[model samples]
Target: MTGVTQQAKSSKDRILEAAVAMTGENLGAGLSVRAVAARAGVSTGSLRHHFPTQRALQEAVLTAIYDLVIPDDHVIHDTSLPARDRLIACLRLVLAPAAPGKPSREAWSTVYERFIAPEPTEELRATYLATAREGLRRVEYWLSVLVEEGALAAGDNTRRARFLNTVVGGLSVERAMPGEASVLEAETEVLGMAVDAVLASREPGE
Candidate 1:
């Protein structure tokens, strides 16, 4: 019984990994069941057995993508560091590269494509919205932590989180453009400015 459960979990992980790997390049439009099944080394029938529909596969993939855990040594979780610095770390985290050509912007890029496509399917829209919302929730969680630590001024954390997500979204779009419209330095500078604007001034003359 345990062996069967382990095999099932492994198969699911492989499917999700294949979906993530194939998400870029075409903004997820290429993530058809046959393609994913081929990538995962499984039969289409096998994939369908696990996920009854394409929508189910998409939801599972997006969920798994967001569920990709940051390692314990991630900078944001370094509580010994200042909140402003930690927040900047988050900006860097989001701005990092996804594919060599694309940078770490595929999350927003795919969602944008889905949003503007000739009439997105409800499942596509819902999956992307949930993925994006989860990102904002993380920002809010970080802000609340900083607020508790007295590093950020207490306010409507939800709004603050949305604002941060907006900034990242803008950067993501820029990075996704044809040319090098958004450079890494510019991304860091804007994020630094935004973080400074939000953090509570603790020093006498900061």
Candidate 2:
């Protein structure tokens, strides 16, 4: 029984990995079960064994992507750092590339573009929104913690989370456009301005 459980878990992981890879290539389209199964080198029956419906598979994919893009490590909950600093750290992690090059940035832009599209099926929309809501929830959760720590004011954390998400969404769209080095710099500058504006909006003396 234990072995069966481990095998099932491994299969689920493979399906999710395959979905991520496929989504990277075709972000705007829904990934087919057969395609994902093929990518994972598993039979369709095997894929269905783990995810009975396309919605299930797609939700799993979004969940996996969200986990990779915004892992727990990105949310700083340290009590030592001032609330403002922690908020900045969280914003930087959400906006800036995790490395020197902008591969992660490009990848995330692709994901965001997919999210904003109208072609996705209802299942996809539900899955996408749920994943996005979870991401916002994490931001709000951290912000609330900071508020309790006397770092942020006692205001609407929900609205603040939505605002931050909008900022990231707009930045991702700008970054997704085809541009030269100068254009990249402009995009970066715009993102910096957005972050600065949000940080500046914090109330006096929290």
Candidate 3:
């Protein structure tokens, strides 16, 4: 029983990893069960045993990507660091270049591309919206903490959180789009301005 359980876990992990790789290669393409099975070095039958269906596999892969992009260990609430600095660190983590061989940027690009599609399949749409909401929830939580810490004003934290999230999302889109050097530079400057504006809005007492 233990051996079987271990093997099943390993197989599932392989499927998730392969799905991420395929998503990275083509942000707009849907991952087929056969392609994922092939990448995982397993037969379709074996893959089905773990995932049941393509939707199940896709959701699992999407959830796995979310975990990687915002790992639990990330400092979402570090009171020692000023709120602005902590927020900046959070932004940097999301925007930083992927590790040498990892496909972090590509995975993020794929997620955003899927989220903004005009009409995704029901399952895909649900997955994208859920992922976006989860991100927003986390940002809101952190923003509230900052407000409680007196780093920000007592005004509407919800609106502020949404604004910051929108800015970040827009910047991510710009970075992913085909662009010339000037365009990329403009996107970077815009992100900087967004952050500066947020920081500048702090109350005098804060």
Q: Global lDDT of each model?
A: 0.69, 0.68, 0.67
Better of 1 and 3 by lDDT: 1
Candidate 1 lDDT score relative to the true structure: 0.69
Worst 10 residues of 3 by lDDT: 96-105
Candidate 3 pairs with clashing backbones: none
110-169 in candidate 3: lDDT tens per residue? 565666645777756665665566667666666777677777666655666678889877
Error of 1 at 170 (Å): 1.2
Best by lDDT: 1
In model 2, how many backbone clashes occur? 0
Can you tell me which runs of candidate 2 are displaced by over 4 Å? 1-9, 43-49, 72-75, 98-131, 144-156, 171-206
CA RMSD (A), model 3: 7.1
Candidate 2, poorest ten consecutive residues by summed lDDT: 95-104
Residue by residue across 169-202, what tens digits does model 2's lDDT show? 6655555555454754665566566545554556
Model 3, CA-based lDDT? 0.67
How big is the positional error of residue 171 in model 2, measured in Å on the Cα after superposition? 4.2
What order do you get sorting by TM-score, best first?
1, 2, 3
